[model samples]
Target: MRYDVVVIGSGFGGSVAALRLAEKGYSVLVLEAGRRFADHELPRTSWRVRRFLWAPALGCYGIQRITLLRPAGRRGAGGSRAGGTGRGKTRAGQSGGRAGVLVLSGAGVGGGSLVYANTLYEPPADFYADPQWAGITDWRAELAPYYARAKQMLGVVDYPRTTAADKVMRAVADRMGAGDTFRSTPVAVYLGRPGERVADPHFGGAGPDRAGCTHCGSCLTGCRVGAKNSLPKNYLWFAERAGARIRPLTTVVGLRPGPGGAGYLVDVRRTGAWAGGRQTIAADQVVLAAGALGTQRLLHTARATGALPAISARIGALTRTNSEAILGASVPRRAARRRRLDFTDGVAITSSFHPEPGTHVEPVRYGPGSNLMGLLQSALVPGGPCRVRRWLAALAGRPRDTVRLLSVRDWSRRTVVALVMQSVDNSLTTYHRRGRLVAGHGHGRSNPSWIPAGHRVVRLLADEIGGIPGGAVTEPFDVPMTAHILGGAVIGATRADGVVDAYHRVFGCPGLHVLDGAAVPANLGVNPSLTIVALAERAVAHWPVKGAPDRRPPAS
Candidate 1:
């Protein structure tokens, strides 16, 4: 079938593009590589790893695809193979190249929203001061109204400060003399009376029915109660009602110029079926919204295979991870066994505060029965070559302490994780090797440890909370895992600087655009969902109406 616009990957960017283009009277087709999840279909708990995680080859097709690469090991890493089974660089998956790509992202129809903490924060004023983004359309001013529109569409609101974790975050902020920076996080969950089911409040009663937030703290596991405002609940939801077609479990495999150079041809393979089959379709325009990893991999493949040689050489540069760190502590022994703190009583991130300039920390939690994350933590140790050695020493020296954390009884209720993010600029370039996309850090920076500010705050929080502080397993290995991975196909003044223009159009491939995290040029030191959505809104706003004369400059 032919479409006026074919949007790939139904995440924040793709969903907004599909909805907007459809609104402009275009026949839109949105192809999602993951399955469409119904509210009841969401896993009740995250422990069902096989059902809650996403690894199609492993028969797991839910949200939350956790990719872990063992940093650059001895002899310098060349990248690792990816997939549920089979061993080859030709398979369809993101390769963890030389330096390794340790990231936490979402899958399925609604993309990250299906598994995100739902925090919708606007970046601080200084975000616009980055030299890399200077003179790029006065971003803050241009996006102000769009940010408001995105907030309204996503149902963003100030978090209700009613959880123990919330109080703890505020207290920590006050004790540090930064009380003014401590505030409730803006979240996308419904705030009507708890457990109340009401007609859609944001879409003039024309959208899906939503349930009020019950504060299950399971936003990362998928919102089974419909309180979480995932993309399917808003943009994608409305797009379908407005004549856009959404096909889930269909993965795009190839792209080539269309007949007569008026459009493009796209090939897709069916996911989760035996004896793979393929189909091709035509689209006048293509908008990539496959998140950072997915979009980077696809664009890299296209460029390397000569399918789209016109793409800029800067296809996968400036990949940012929000300078992120996952740091937190288990509840104190006295509080855990006596006071019985319920860490899972509120939204995923109830409150946050700035502990240092360009850095922000928020209290993150999981719902009851979701103790799987406990496995990702280890004893916190200071940075250096001996960090991993020290962690091992602590583990071997205190076996019982380790066992206590691994035991699942009330684990979710007894622990809180701090989601740390920073605006500090640093990046890696991704390139294809042996048919897999891998990142390469320039100039011998083999291992870049987490920012020291993150470590300091983590240590302080652990001390104040009366709990044993710990760091993510990757931290010891000089690799900090991140949830908000941005950049890669970023905006720039020319093709030499970036793959896309400020308008999100490909530098050489007209009618092809990147409107996702991949287009983001710098870290915002906050959850990037709201920023991505606002940027997408801007990308769509610049697009001429479908069937109208194309106003974009012709490829040079």
Candidate 2:
């Protein structure tokens, strides 16, 4: 059977598309390459190591190797697969590729909303300043309503400052004279009296019944308590109720545009820890919402093999990592072991700091069970012969010092995980090599303005909290890791400069569209998921449904 639309990847973008398209009375088939998890099936405690972190045994997390190549698309430093078992199967159960795509995206039914920190913010004005974007769409105006719609649907709320971590961080900021910089961040968490269920509090009761946050601190562990709002709780949930079929662990490998005016043929596969199988899907329109890494790999492979040769030569050009850096500092030794310090119990990201003009800093928390502290401490321990001798001497003189020092201490009181994001724009491209994605060349000059600005904020955090500043020690040659990767297959004025048109449609491929972070024209200096959702809503509004006239007239 054919579908009106086959959406690839079920993350934020695809989830919204599936819901809206299905609500319009179309047969929408969502193909997700990851497995599905029920609310009850999610891990309850961080100590449940297998389930807490994305692992093959838990049927979550994809272990794909990711390498960063130079801008010239030539050789650069290669990296190893970071963590987790390189096991499990796709929906088709196929395996055996280097795990270079180490993104923390949601693979199952809910998508990244399930795994991501629930920080949601509006895109800044600079986002619409691109000349290329002005020709195709008026993003600022077109997306305003959709942004409000998405916020309500996601149950976005202000974080409560109840936890010890929140209190201490605020005190530190106040003491350091940067009190104005620290404020409660907007989050997509349920915030009402405990166990009180309300139906669509944001909407006019058209959405789901959401129980308020219990402050379980399990937001990162998948919100088993139903307090953390994710797409599965609203959009996807509503879509299913409206008759959309969400096929998890079902990976779409290839696409063949149909003959004449027919739609497209989508090649499918299965994945998990099990064996593999294959199938085909016929659809009149295809929405590629497979996240940046997944979609780039698929489209690059298709172009290499001439499957869709009309794809622009600029397919993988203009990529961006959103100028993000995950800088963290451990809590002081005295505060380490307090059970009441439960970092995971409050909002995932409570307060933010803007010490400079373009940079934004926010507090992030990880449960003790996450072992993130151990990693940070290990990295902070000074190295070299003096360090080794000092460690040995300390071990002999103060036997338990090392372990005790590493213990969960009053540090959470003074410590805050500040996620530094900047408006200074920088991006990397993508290319296919031996059937995998390697970072494209042209690693632009590190945005000097943003770096100093971020450092100033970190210093302010240190001064306010009486804590040490910390982050990954990258050598002069090493690149930083970013969670917010965007661009590539960007929307451009013409097919010559981009893969898609301003309306996000593939120039030559009439019915295909890309509606995700990949299509963003510029860095919004903020978390992009909200903006992406709004853009998808706008794209769907422009979709030529049964009753609508085509917005763009056909070739003359």
Best by lDDT: 1
Candidate 1, which segments miss by more than 4 Å at Cα?
69-98, 332-335, 442-448, 551-556
Please give the CA lDDT of all the candidate structures. Answer: 0.79, 0.64
Writing each residue's lDDT as its tens digit, candidate 1 over 424-524 gives 55556666765666666622132234556556666777676677677787776667778888888988867877788888888888789898999987778
Q: Per-residue CA lDDT of candidate 2, range 273-371, in tens?
A: 355587888999899998877777778887899888777767666566665655655545554334333455576677775655456666677543544
**Candidate 2: count of backbone clashes, pairs at least 3 residues apart or interchain:** 37
**lDDT for residue 220 in candidate 1, whole number 0-100:** 88
Top candidate, metric TM-score: 1
Clashing pairs in model 1? none
Q: How accurate is candidate 1 locally (lDDT)?
A: 0.79
| TM-score attained by model 2 | 0.82
Q: After TM-score superposition, what is the CA distance of residue 333 in candidate 2 from its true location, in Å?
A: 4.5
